[model samples]
Target: MDLELFLQQLANAISLGSLYALLAIGYTMVYGILRLINFAHGDIFMFGTYMAFYMMTSFLLPWGAAFFIAIILTIAFGVLVEKAAYKPLRNSPRMSIMISAIGASFLIENLAIVVFGGRPKSLPVPDLFNRIIHIGNVSVVSITFITPIITMVALAVLMFIVNKTKTGMAMRAVSKDYEAARLMGIDVNFIITFTFAIGSALAAIGGIMWGLKYPSLLPLMGVMPGLKCFIAAVIGGIGDIRGAVIGGFILGLIEIMLIAVFPELTGYRDAFAFVLLIVILLVKPTGIMGKNIAEKV
Candidate 1:
């Protein structure tokens, strides 16, 4: 590919990667603490998009305020999901929790269809995000450039919260050993809830970005991206935060570059993530950053 084409695709990859990174972080965080894959997470992402859409259209709010409200509401919804769907099953078999997660995902999607309607809604683009910037032979939107910076800042904040805060310590302890953490007087339930809140908040950020980039929202919109982000989490090391970011970038770059170089493969673009997932699983089940642990059983 020519330098200009490469640059343009690079910009696209970076923006797309930012969204995946945000979503993947949520997946990894929840898995780290609960050892359960929250299948409903993608639905939370879908809700974020719809929340932002209604806030802008129905509430007549500005993009900034609407986006903020969407994130807050999305966080609350996530926490509520955990409390209602997963909490009661905490002491049950692991399969029960997983099944509940799947059931909750479907429930959210169906509810979204009923409430948000079956038709797709157009996402309102703020004037600022629509501006284009030119660099040499490459031109891209302002949001394209801004997204990576936002992702980096968010990552820094997440790292600080995970590494430096007292809650972070509790989270680490719980992830390491829930029973042990409880024995040490850590509020395991509160930590788990907090993790869900943070993860759902990240999903909201990603959903907002996804709506902006795609400009179309539907109840099923989160399904594909949600699965892709899960694949990214697995590829990067399922429970490792930093690894998820790396995996997101890898997935984004590969997808963009494949479509750019071979237009024919555009039809199969989504399959590439699954193909990558399979390869990663076959070659290194633990992922790049995940360490294999020996079970006592």
Candidate 2:
């Protein structure tokens, strides 16, 4: 590919990768803290987008206000899912929790179909995001450039919260040993809830970005992205925050580059993630940046 074409493809890859990174972080965060995959997370993403859509179109709110409200609502919904689906199974077997997660995911999807209708809704794109920008020989939409910046800023803020704050310390403690953290007076439940809130917020932002980039909404929209991001998280080492970002970028780049170099394989783009997952499992089960952890008896 020529330099201009390569740059264009690269921009698209980065934008796609940033969205994956944002969503992958949520998976990693919850897995890190609770060792549970929030299967309903993708639905939570869909929920946020729909909420924003309605707020803008039905409520007649500005895009900024709609997005803010959507994020808040998504966070609350996420927390509610935790309390209803996962919290009760906290002390139960891991299999039980996983099943509950799956059930919750299905419940949300069906509910969305019932309430939002089966027809796909078009997300109202803001002019700011729709504007085209030119740089030398490469031209792209504003969101193509904006996505990576937002991802980076979100990552930085998350890192600071996870590494520098008291809550961060508590989260680490709880992750290590929930009972021990509770014994030490840390509110384990609260920490878990907070983690979900943050994860949900990231999902909300990612959903909004995805809506802007794709501009189409469906009840099942989050399923593929959710599964892909889960793959990204696992590939990057599920519990490592930085690793999740790396995994997302790697997945995005590979997907875009594969299709660009060989358009015939475009049909198999989704399969690539699974193939990569299998390779990673065989080569380095702990992931590129993951450390081996012994399971407790």
- Show model 2 residue runs off by greater than 4 Å: none
Candidate 1's error at 39, in angstroms? 0.6
> Model 1 off-target regions past 4 Å?
295-297
Q: What number of clashing residue pairs does each candidate have, in the order they appear?
A: 0, 0
* Candidate 1 local Cα displacement, residue 95, angstroms: 1.1
Q: Top model by lDDT, which number?
A: 2
lDDT of 2: 0.94
Residue 252 of candidate 1: its Cα lDDT?
A: 95
lDDT of 1: 0.92
Worst 10 residues of 1 by lDDT: 288-297
lDDT of each: 0.92, 0.94
Question: How far in Å is the alpha carbon of 85 misplaced in model 2?
Answer: 0.1
- By TM-score, how accurate is candidate 1? 0.98
The TM-scores of all predictions, comma-separated, are 0.98, 0.99
